[model samples]
Target chain A: MKLTKSFNRSLWVFHLNTGSCNGCEIEIVATICPRYDPERFGIKLVGSPKHADVLLVTGPVTKKMAAKVRRVYEQVPDPKLVMCIGTCGQSGGVFYDSYNLDGPIDQVLPVDVYVPGCPPRPEAIVYGVVKALEKLERLEAAQ
Target chain B: MLTDIILTLAGAFLVVIFSLIVAFFLLGVDRIVTARMQARIGPPLTQPFTDMRKLFTKENVVPANAIPWLFNLAPVVALASAITILLYIPIGGFPPVLSGGGDLILVMYLLTLPALALVAGGFSSGSPYATVGAQREMVTMIAYEFPLAVVIIAIAWKLAVSGVPLPFMLMSIQANPVWGLVGPLGIIGILILFFVLLIVTPAELSRIPFDTPEAETELAGGVLVEYSGKNLALFTLTQGVKTVVMASLMVALFIPYRLSALVPAPAILQPVLDLLFYLILVVLVAFVAVSLIRVSMARFRINQVVSVYWIYLSLIGIAGLLLVMADHFIGVV
Candidate 1:
């Protein structure tokens, strides 16, 4: 993982939904609205995982989505950060202990930053990104 | 002869570096201007630089299904061909470094090389999305070529009938300002042709409103879905260079007048004034063609793109061509 200041400033994120309700996804969209304007920090929502430096994975991984999630995680180029958004991805939230369960995301792929809420507010998502940035900066310093 | 060769080599090196810098600067300006228009504070002007640097540090992924050599070759070819086009077109107040080596016809063909390289890359990536994108890109290239050819041929044709030597050469075109060659009716014709060319610029560069090949919402980055890291960065740079190419061509053909020619300036400062004027002209053309059109309109469907250029714009171009022809006949009689 080659961490640099440039990487921290311009993190192109690819959002993946692993079968959560659409709540987290809507919040993710809101994070990019003109009011929030994540682009000011050079953070953009790219369409492809290949172009992404940060993977914003929403939802707890359903059995069907676990493999796809893993593939997407792999697709992102190295030195990547994964943020598990919403409580569902952290511990299955409302879906906890379900019969078809395959995730709390971490079980399926490495999780770097977790934003926990039934559906985290857009502010929480932004703060989670700041935390991710701090982690990236720390990694840069350690190098 | 040796000195000529050395000077040409030096000029090529300087122009490449200068074009790269100017391309990035124009892209940054486009983003900021677009952001302001949308009522949002945009990223800083240095954002594209940071994005390019970050991409270089990331892993360069070669998809398992891809033809690695062709996939890797695409970006280099795209960027190189784009810069090659710049070498033949006038820049600022100076004539092209390789002005006599190639002319308008060669430039029209060179203009297609980057897009062809893109299509080649997209097909080689082995992604279903990339395949679809490549098809759409090819369609776009064909759709725009008619009006583009019409505009170029009309100008050259007009110059030829007027008995200007080497009408196909950019130097002759610049020297004989197409605007001055025609009368009232021809001015209207030239304006129409200019308008058609302006509409074609965005499609040529594949920016918004005509960016069907990379439609993020529908195809998920389309032709670029499988590209990552350094290859992606180079493609981004190629896009910037292509924007400069299209804008410079617009400047060369329609708005070739120089600030130095308009106002008497000291010999040394003349090029400086002309370069600044040229930059302003490029920015204005880009804003109208790329940024304004991008913001005001939504993407056109692939079929709509074909009809819009082939049927509508071609008609407008022909109308302009006819007017120019009429102006010539009327003048000769």
Candidate 2:
């Protein structure tokens, strides 16, 4: 019980780069800066999806990546969170019209919170994350 | 008012410039860190800036079938939205230019507009790659959005219930103490919040783990497959600025300290020094959290990604909320 409590207290996040120009990837890294100290909030980034409670995904889904995206998403244990990070992830932004790209993330998955930004700031990401947690609790209570 | 505007603008300019520099530094740091973890030397810190400059001078190409206006507008809007977020945040104890009631919510919405603009821009291109990228982008957004929203509301609720007498604006939370991520439950809430942010951060910026959208190995640059020249450069700049903005927000909300916290310096000097301090701190955190994780971790499947967030993390969030509520009731009783 204590283990579950502590584990509940600290959620390990995993990041996945579907496909991006490395722009959003850098921003994602910025969120972990000491100034942000998400750890203070008991938030951490884990090395594997199996250990992760949330999956942070960026980039527009390409057909080739679809399987990989699905595969990784499946690897995460039950009751996980998925967050699409950039405009590219949300709607493929500048890549929307490309033949090689898939449409917005929703076609493949059900998103809980839409954190829109070509690349949202770390704080915005944090805010979206906090919001997602609240939503999760609400959903669970109802369930 | 004029003085405030001038100060705010100057501060914003500095913030934008600094954020870009920091972004470049992070890119280099990330590469070096990853390389070190993998037993190699990484690219130079200035590589991103150089790459952007080169892309700027490269040949500008427009798709023959694309809507020229939308394509052009996409990058501009993305950049603008990123800059706007910078202006609204508190850095080193300095409030943003547009700080007001529920501005945090506004910031939240504004952050996503750039992505929406990008999608529109891609759709305007009328290319298959761009279309596919847009679809994938949309899917990823759909997958993670709910959890993100829940996390935000939790923090806002905590602040609101704590009896801090300001609007639940992002700026107010920064300027006051009630919004601080302090308390054990708050810490737990923040931990879950952090994990959710960590996962989404890559997706928000389209990095590894959640980087399936533009898998060049698979999709040929995904959404940006057709973009080149200045348009690409614009996208590059926006990416850098967004990174800084994300980092800054974390500093404002989680850390919430400024140069002013160090000494009784003049207000102007304090904000500047605080901004610098915040940036340095961001650099340090990146070294551990992102750079380290990217090098060590691999990616996950899309459904697994969705289920974990919706089911698992949400359950954690529920527990946290219940604890908080219990704490609140116990305190009242």
Candidate 3:
């Protein structure tokens, strides 16, 4: 589905945690601080995936969580984006190639933007959101 | 007669549009005020409009197990009934389009229609989370209903006791301005009831300190867990419209005074002044009932919700009712 500027502006994101050690989760929380205030851009954290336009995935996918992540990705309505929020979701961070692992999140779901830090800072999360909007613009231009 | 009917239909259409504009503006103001209270820059005032556009264009998803017909109908019912409420209550200096002798009671009963639509929607969604939410919504409705009734009846009863014919008419209540009919003791009582109704406003809107049904952290959107796209957008609209309805009700009941009376406006300018003044009052009332308390409190447990309204607010409402009655029978009202 082609994206519109309205879709880009009012991005309702649902955060998914597969197997993060809580580092990225803390940064995600920090991104909502009065200092950061993502709401100024109309970025809201919605509880239901069905109401979301974007999914923020953090942490490497554990074997037990792989299916749940897939289920959640499908739960979001059409015209969606998946943003990988930490290095853990890209290369498993310190847990790379460990037993009981099933990820790097891209293996289980299509990731549109990756912010690669062991745990990215809140500033990085904000940049990741900007990059996501740029990607939307690219998609709109292509159409 | 046919032309008359067409004119009424056209007028009703215009009023519905006006109400929708006010409702959305109220929601945007709410977000901005809540953000400022938290020391954050909020979304633009046009954010709700942007959201509605995106939602209308997005894909509408129906849960496989859900009853499709009922699911689709719920949102339409919810929005329609909410807008229906705006038509019965007086706006600015104009009488209600459908004004009648006892339509205050009609407005009270109509207040429950949007809630009932929500309950129906939740029950039909076929999700365990929604089922729990529907139950909580039903419980919240039952808990808040008595005090709501008490508040309305107290004012009307005072009007009756004060010798106004057709005391149940909103026009009568508008003419009387319950605040003036009461002496000092009754003033205190009316103030108490005013406070109780302010507290009840959050519950009626399912806002925080009473928002267990949609507790996001726990139930993941609860009753709305399964709704998506257009359906969710309609429910969102219903929420904004309901806020306007509750705030308007409070305005009509307590502060229905017109600015034209004070300023002595010419005939051409009377409605313009009254309309501007009415909007200002609605904004203030919405700030108090919806935004202020929402920012100040946390969600209540379902059990606590029941006891708070049933035991605490009910007693307070009855006390106010008695005082209004007493102020009439005794001296200085």
Docking level of model 3: high
Give lDDT for model 1: 0.94
For model 2, how does the per-residue alpha-carbon lDDT over B8-73 read when each residue is reduced to its tens digit? Answer: 678767877766677777776676566556654444555555555545544455667889999888
Which candidate, 1 or 3, has the higher lDDT? 1
Candidate 3 residue runs with Cα over 4 Å from true position: none
DockQ of each: 0.90, 0.02, 0.85
Strongest candidate by TM-score: 1
| Candidate topping lDDT | 1
> How high is the DockQ of candidate 1?
0.90
DockQ of 3: 0.85
Clashing residue pairs in candidate 3 (N, C-alpha, C atoms within 3 angstroms): none
Query: What are the per-model C-alpha RMSD values against the true structure?
Result: 0.9, 19.7, 1.3
| Displacement of the residue B55 alpha carbon in candidate 1, Å | 0.7
Candidate that beats the other on TM-score, 1 or 2, i.e. the better one: 1
Global lDDT of each candidate: 0.94, 0.68, 0.90
How would you encode candidate 2's per-residue C-alpha lDDT over A1-143 as one tens digit per residue?
01222333445577888887777778777877655656544466655454456788888888788888888786655556788888888888998989997656776766667777877888888888888777766665565
Best by DockQ: 1
What's the ranking of the predictions by DockQ, best on top? 1, 3, 2
For model 3, how does the per-residue alpha-carbon lDDT over A1-143 read when each residue is reduced to its tens digit? 65788999999989999999999999999998899999999999999999999999998999999999999999999999999999989998898999978999988999999998878999999999999999999998898
